[model samples]
Target: MPLLDPARWRLLHGGEAAAVEPATGEALGTFTLAAPSDVEEAALTAARAQRAWATAPYSERAAVLRRAGDLIRRHEPEIGEWIVRESGSIRGKADFEIRTASEECYEAAALAHRPLGQVLPSTAPRLSYTSRIPAGVVGVITPFNAPLVLAARSVAPALALGNAVVLKPDPRTAVCGGHALAAVFAEAGLPEGLLRVLPGGAETGRALVEDPRVRVVSFTGSTRAGRAVGELAARHLKRAHLELGGNSAFVVLEDADLDAAMSTAAWASFFHQGQVCMTAGRHLVHSSRYDEYVERLAAKADSLTVGDPYREQVHLGPVIDRGHLDRIDELVRGSAAAGVRIAAGGRYRDLFYRPTVLADAGPGSVGASPAYGREVFGPVAPVRAFDTLDEAVALAGDSGYGLALGIVTRDTARALDLADRVPAGLVHINDQTVNDEPIAPFGGLGDSGTGSRFGGEANLDAFTETRWTTVRATPAAYPF
Candidate 1:
């Protein structure tokens, strides 16, 4: 009867996950998850060990990352299937998650030896330099959209910088995350305390963030959750890296390629049932070809076959669960009622929301409706046609959230101009908004997030801190 009862999460490394039915818990079949309370203890133990682990040598950290990456590749298929079972993402999508995570690890390894700190030549006789250092034990709260890869964004960087990590994956998708991360560390010979995987709901995450041992919190979740993490971190004066909600914009100029932009927009907006925070939340098209673009996009959105995640033929998958489906439905219906047109989809069923698209909606219709705000984490993409580039740019900035923006056009000047004007953390030219490069920095500007996720040295920046080391010219002279 319950949505997440009998089929529950197993607290890995809390001990062996023996068959013991947790009382009053829900499950899909026979396995019941560990209570949130039990999960907290595991996190505490990891936190206890994180301190010393953060001091591990750079070579050692690099080895750990490389090994973890190897293990991820070795178990890619199993991990992919696990992602589908745990987070409701499709098999192909799951593979993408695992694959992308492996790349992060690989990138982190390269960064481990890439020289983080710099020592500039000082005019004085003192050796004054700045070196990037670890921020102690880090708490990574990853969502289900891209569990494995997103988890690595924090984990790899922290480990590379000699900071141990305690990853608190979203309860719905913690299984694959816990296993995928810990399994690699194990293969790489990282000690238990170096990287710990704990699975639970909000309480588990709260405990980790609020823990004194956790010096930094890198979280990826809803805006509300981001605020919660920020508040908890603030209480203890700990650093918080909040990658929150985003209502991304996809801008299409008249000269843009029809096939390329429409195809990418369809997948970018509704990919993973549109559960991605960076998914195209808004589609702003030029008036010259607005009608044609909307038609192609709507057709693309409508044609996606859904149902089973394991099916190869299915490019679309269910939202995380029925609860997410309900939320998407509510947002869509409310938008429709508020005089915003549901240009494409507002359908819901048992754990399935058909790929949907909404277009020609008013920007301020409901003070940031689904078209402008509210991340519809499902198969819903809203389109708003614009007559001028300025109108498109304004629409992009119309929302409170500005995580990512996608612009499709051939003119280099136009792309560059829009990229400068757009207020998103990430800007994609002639591609989907959801893509992330391992070397380029990814983050949001407003309610989208505070810190960044992917980049060459910036990823390291989020996990590590800078300690100014200076030798004064006059060592004996003190400030008055």
Candidate 2:
């Protein structure tokens, strides 16, 4: 089987947009962007398909998802390359994402056969039960970073639950992540028109969200965009599941092993150029080990190779675009101007920024500072020293965004205690902040998201509606 061509896909219906390579600013291909009319058409078509699909047997639905996973694994190499060129992801990271996406399909397939309802004891001489039904059409809007996996997190589960999908991926990585995914599902025997991939910008997304036929909206992007999506879904009385921006904190206690802490810190801070929502932006180290940890971490950051994403030896890749690169530079420069010590890497060559570390990044209470309060969305780690465990917990819980947090400590009891106190949705005891699995609940709290989890059994809740039923052997006599 050859790679899926974007031009031959089903949902191309508007002006063309150029897909540019972040490494060299070169055009990889031109993709058709979806218009407003296209969005509406897709939604209506999905609604019709979903009504039919929802009646299909669970075994058939699970088979389709399993086949989709098999196809993804077989084409992992080709898909991984597209991810590298289009999203500027390194070879390792791209491969990991492909594998993760494939596993998501398999996991979701299992849910199709699992129980989706319960029977309750009657209260007044009647039988009562509840059944979960599909939400009709799911609107999935994904971001450029980790597009394939993020799309699968919602799309696979929606399909398994008998819902159709209208996916609008980021214009920057449409061909590889969006178009290719639709092609795989189609080849795996999904009903025609059940899954439509619409690649476009904000207008396309808004059209999908506002469409009444689209019953559920699942979005993964920045907080600002998520807020608008949430408001629109609210007005339309549609279900909305949002996974927004994050500023995860990495706490290193006095008893932490410096070597292990350094390695985990580098991975959490610099992977995917730190564009991930769960990337660690703040490092709160105990005062006893602050200086040593900062020095070793800076050395590790300097040792990493930042170059072409296709190269096997390259550890870091370019940002998504020039505008994002400039934004990261501005944040780093502003932090420096605010007296934050730049321990290493405050420079960039084109879109490729060096892994940066800022020491003694003061309270980071202001919006202008990217250390604690703001989401950096770049490969920069800000460090702040805390003298006591209470102070460290305070620092970890300081941010308005409560997505994830990590603590490296030898004391298991203390780690559990701290995890209980932290406001983040995902907490890591002896690990980094960037951990995720297909079977775990994935979401955030507060400004980070709308508190809708999106994995394992959680998907059943997000993509289905419960219908209560009651039955009685005979009607009761009534007197007026």
Candidate 3:
């Protein structure tokens, strides 16, 4: 009950709670962690709500979404601060998140009027038609990093598809996420129970995913948690969307402008202190420009000031919490022990790890070693130099995870070549792959994630499914 304490907003749903400290594995805050029985009650309430919600016309549903987006835009400054404080993302990073969230909401709202399907010209005297239909209810479990963007990406699509949504935000960032979203929709005159914001941790997520009423579970986070959610959803034969981990690489070819590469790397890996799943945690450069690139990158990286997220001069911020600081430290020491040159940084202050970079991060280099294979989930990138494009691509593909990758090059053919060879879902040329607009699809492949490409027109597929009802116009022939 301690985890459920109402220290913040009364969790969107009902429950008793307690405050506890996860950092020291002791109670630091009063919070109510969801219990199984409470979860069941919430699920029942959601199911009953969906029955009424599913009947609402798409146009009417879209109105609220449009207004919600409008409200978000009007309060960008306030919402931006919420994101920065909760995620510890820098001001620029937080602004980007807000923009991404707003854009996605607009697109989702517009989708309600878009054509769904075409009527086929039939040879026989019969009518044939197909169209997208809401999945009834969708469960969205968001991550702490860029909470608003991720939440919007999931919720917008479901709402556009006309599926009622129960958004469960990350406990760490819930203060602004679910509560703010709930406010926006309420302002838009959304029907009660149509779009709810429920905030909590593991138990809350588990309950939402396992609820039979939930038709789809859209999750973005670690592979371990995704797998657990997937298994649980599978037990009920439900559909699940998982956007998992990544250790994306930024590959700078010999022809790439060193300045541009450094700029891209600095933003990609350190923008949010490298908490983004698509952040370029690994930097692989061609040997010809490798030394020059790293020097420029280190210079630029070192110049970045880490301070309060709301400060304009600050390019970096705290690493979410102290646990992350320790994790970044482990990467530094482990890689150093592996004979990696600390290169740019391997120090820290409080929960902040100095803007760090590792070089000579070969297969054996401490930070570049196998230990850093998966998503580091922080702002510590290791530089790995290669002689050929083949070698660079190989290093980028070496990890089990494949979400996104970046390539800085001047040659058109070379960029395409690398994009073709890379295993990531999204690849960027001459810029950091982490740079994205909600208009474009973003997801992952392999261990990075297991979800359909979402965003744009295709996003409707994630929230709505297709079902064909065939009626033979002609009399049944023998065995027809």
Candidate 4:
């Protein structure tokens, strides 16, 4: 039987939603949409199951996660196929997602063995200590871009920490992101009801956040949506872990290696068609090399191919759907209208938007364009010139987002100095902006999110609450 077999769980409502292939506009399959009532039921079910799952042996929980990781690795080809066809990911990106998702499970398994509490000194004649306890049921809302890895990072850790999860994956990539993840857990012997996959839209996400039984909400999406989720979660008095959007900056110093820097910039800006939250949307190069940098980057962008990844060996796939394609096109066109020279690529065919580079997007002109500091989640790189380190730092931190920042220079000391002044949560002195590791804490600052980092030791803090306890051999005298 398939892991996503409808018989496994009750998907309320008589209607179904289609999961269409973005590249071909063909229906890959259909899934029942969960109503608000169904979300309520899922939370209740997860809460009930969490009681037993929480008390289960830590070894058992760890085993389940480890097995899931193995299963994902074992079925990489099959799952990769689903990701490519459903999410419009290039084959290389699909492979990266599979590998990273599996690593998330493996790392989460290790989380089971981390120190759960600490002993503290007490003022009285008593033993005092703190214990980390699960936060009951957790609500996870994941976006379509890089869904598998994003979902796994939260789901695996929540489960490993003894909390049940009710996942709401983006409906568009449900098959690869939602069903595949749940299937791996089921095959790994995870207890039923401990994890629920409810592929849905905003209504479903809101329902999950508002559900009383869900104590913690893990969300990954746009900054606008993340703000709403944070507000709603706060109104409900629940903790929300939001890893939102970014218009990250990639700074190139006069002393940097243009060849290597440009390569990193291309990958950072155009990887996965730049759907990533950490995409290097702004490029600040020193005035000495600004023109050369733009020309070389434009040539690189033009050399890359965009097509249906499932049928061709291409650098990039479709831009998720027509709506997303239109949004990217609008950004490029709007910037061009504002006198931002289009160094290369300002067009698209079907759903494939070409990788574009904008030059002469200085502080005065492009800064006024909508695509300047805004999160243009597409394959568009806007380059600006900076004269000194101070100006570069100012330009990089000018945006409301402070998710990730990159600085490339041979002067390690200067690069480190620049990193100190940047407001971003994650910074790379010698590398590009788009980077993630299962063991590293990942998050952003300001409008980007609440700075509730995820992964490694941070997962324990995000998924569990600390309870202080004290024991005494005799009762203390009371003032009564």
Indicate whether candidate 1 or candidate 4 has the larger TM-score: 4
Give the Å shift of residue 182 in candidate 2.
0.3
TM-score, model 2 to reference: 0.98
How does model 2 fare in lDDT?
0.90
- Scanning candidate 3 in windows of ten residues, the lowest lDDT window is 19-28
Residue 178, model 4: lDDT of: 87
Q: Which of candidates 3 and 4 reaches a greater lDDT?
A: 4
Question: Clashes in model 4: which pairs?
Answer: none
User: What local lDDT score does residue 80 receive in model 3, on the 0 to 100 scale?
Assistant: 74
lDDT of each: 0.73, 0.90, 0.75, 0.91
Query: Model 4, range 1-480, lDDT digits (tens) per residue?
Result: 334564443366625888888999998777887888889998999999999999999999999999999999888888898899999999999999999999999999999888989999988999999999999999999999998999999999999999999999998888788888998999999999999999877888899999999999999999999999999999999999999999999999999898788789899899999999999999999999998999999999999999999999999899888888898888888888888899989889999989999997755544467677578899999999999889999999898899999999999999989999989999998899989999999999997888999989999999999999999999988799
lDDT of 1 by residue, 355-470 (tens): 87776666775544654467777777777788888888888888888788888899968888988987878888888888876767878878988755556777777878888787
The TM-score between candidate 3 and the true structure equals: 0.90
Instruction: Report how far off residue 345 is in candidate 3 (Å).
Output: 1.7
Candidate 1 segments exceeding 4 Å error: 1-55, 120-124, 367-371, 471-480
User: Which candidate, 2 or 3, has the higher TM-score?
Assistant: 2
Name model 2 segments beyond 4 Å from true: 9-11
- The total number of steric clashes, by the backbone 3 Å criterion, in model 4 comes to 0
